[model samples]
Target: MSRRTVLVTGATGTTGSRVLAGLRQRGVAVRPASRRGAPAFDWGDQDTWVDALVDIDTLYVVPPIEDSPTGVPRGMGDISGFCKYAVKQGVDRFVLLSARSGRAGNPEVVAVEDVVKALGVEWTILRPSAFHQNFAENFQLNSANPLRQSIVDGSLEAMDLGSPIDFIDAADIADVAVETLVGTGHHGQTYELSGPRAFPFAEAVRIIARTLDRPIQYTEFQPTAWFERLRATGVDETVIGLVEHVLHSHDSGVFAGEFDTVERLLQRPPRSFEAYVRETAALGVWDMNQAANKAMQHQR
Candidate 1:
């Protein structure tokens, strides 16, 4: 196979970075299109978009972060106008990173999907579950609070930090995205990729605590307290609204199930949660919390 070239937007981000690596592992030529990467690209700015996309047959499009938390590509504006422009620019295959919003036919994503469909190109949609990186990278979970066992159930079956709720790695998403691009069997279809297990938040916290030998815990926030606390974190109002929205999602039972799309499709079990935390910690993410965080993060 003459290795196909791909332009990956958000190439430096958690999942996009991995996706880029995944492409390389498969012997495909990859042009990393991020402000930080070689052919650095930006989403909203038009100048960068065209050139990075030039000569590329496939794209892994992760819309720039919207003020909202759903990770919806267009409703907040960045991608709404870009989709039509992308197909019009002569790109053939598109794999957009979308969230579980508005189902498979969200007006915004569908609008872009419609554009690609009309352009007579092969397109795939990847709707991934919450990332395992969110734990080690979430910032909120790293507190060295006077630690409590109440937040985690050690006896409950648990996996590593990479486990829980089927959190798929970003690179895995990219690998699959690229596969759909070079191959034709997946055109016009959407996939929901998740980690291998359906775990409670408590189990996730417990495992992290045990692995690091830290006393961290998952404290169930009283609704009002939770909102007030997050609000105090200087998170913007829109983001605060999104957090509440997620809590509501959990309350409504929207996030309480497991699906097997990742391992089923890739034929490899996703990395376990504990392995995720341990590795990141060894690399110094969790293992290097500042002395200030020890007091400040736990103070609240």
Candidate 2:
């Protein structure tokens, strides 16, 4: 029998990129599928899907995100349709990346999970908490995002809501994804992965501030002001709405729970927020000079 080839969609994204690295370190054969990747797979283009799935035995699906409040990107092919096609093409197993927020009864998430289950194949769904990397890798450090200016200026703006979020490291999620992809006994399971503990966003910034030994001021915006701040930053309405909803949910204490799924699966405790802050600080992403340099580069 040939070695099983796994196709990983969104291979450049936070968790997807880590998943790719984890699989590679394990010597697993991986085919990365992205719009710009070698196989050139795109969710908006069905013609690109076949080549990405060819001879693949398993899949790691990172569903396409929406730019609209509807959670459906205009002109993107249906993911359920893609799953059906994959099953037809002899892909036997699937690991889907979803969010814990979806557990709150989001219709789009419900539909995706339903289709994956109906595929009649081995499947596992991972519903993880917010990623720890978001602080370092996403809008925080990316100079293209207007939010980076605040970080560079040593001001952290947020709609705190006093939520105790259980943020998981993307690497941990990747570890779990690799295990499920290469091992057995995880099929048909839905794992809720989170950090070892939960804390408010302000506390997380405090950890960072302490690590850097600099006063990184944390400012909480009221709902109206928060919405306006995002708009001033050129954030689209859909994302703004989603952020508002998530923050309100956080205020309602929807994501205050911590899960042991990471430790149980990896036989190691989840990495702490302090660890993330310390390690990320060493990278100088939060350094004023480094962040400003990145911002300048994006401007050019």
Candidate 3:
């Protein structure tokens, strides 16, 4: 039998990076693809697709959100076309990374899944909640993230709209992605993954504060102010729209729930928010110097 050749898009991203590591650990042959990787793949550039898809049996898709000048996202620019090309290349299986917002009728998520399903191939969809890594990596540390400003300015303002979010760990998402990519019994299934429990943003920050033994104050950002803050931080409209949708979901209590999909799929309880906080805190990433170092490491 031929060995499995899995192509992972967004290979250096939060879950994609973890997925790559997990696949390698399992001794699976993985071809990492990004806009600037060895097997370079760009959604807007069809010329790069062939190289990324060659000899690949399965794809672990992390959909790109490339924004156009008009605040519209050209995700996978033409996912349908890409899927057809992959089919032609003998690729028959796909595992897509979607968000919990998909259930709330997120247009981009819906469109991507629709394309994957229409491909007439084995497909699995993972709708994961907000990633716990968001706090330590993207939200607090990543240069592009507006919330990173809070880390510098000592103003940890976020939406405190009373609803609790079940933030799943990216590692858990990667594990499930690996299983669906390599294992069986998950094709044509859509799994809604989440952490074991849900907690409000304030409580989550408090946990981090306690873990770091520092005074990280959480300020409430009303809807308008939140949008304004994002704009002021130079966040583009595409991301702003998505962020607004997510904020609406949370404020209306859509995110105040948990799912057992992680446990059901992985046969183990997902890691808790407090545990994630403690572990990340131990890494000294909350410190500005450490955060800079971590950001540099991620960019590499």
TM-score of each: 0.75, 0.88, 0.86
For 225-277, candidate 1 gives per-residue lDDT tens digits of 75576678776787666555545544544444455666666677767666776
Query: What are the per-residue Cα lDDT tens digits for candidate 3 across 1-300?
Result: 235789998787888899999999999999998877987888778999989998898998877654432221355546778778998899989999977777777676777888898889999999888888877575211246545446433459876665888889999999999989998888899998889988888887787777766777678867788778778979888777876776666677666669888898889999999888888767765676766776799999
Candidate with more favorable, higher TM-score: 2 or 3: 2
lDDT of 2 by residue, 45-161 (tens): 789988998899899988887444333223224687788899999999999997776676554555677778889999999988887877767521123433434565788887757
Q: How many steric overlaps does candidate 2 have? A: 0
Which residue pairs of candidate 3 clash?
A: none
For model 2, which pairs clash?
none
Better of 1 and 2 by lDDT: 2
Worst 10 residues of 1 by lDDT: 145-154
Clashes of 1: 8
Q: Arrange candidates, best TM-score first.
A: 2, 3, 1
**Model 3 segments more than 4 A misplaced:** 1-3, 66-73, 139-153, 228-244, 288-300
Give the per-residue Cα lDDT of candidate 2 at 139.
27
Candidates 1 and 3, the one with greater lDDT: 3
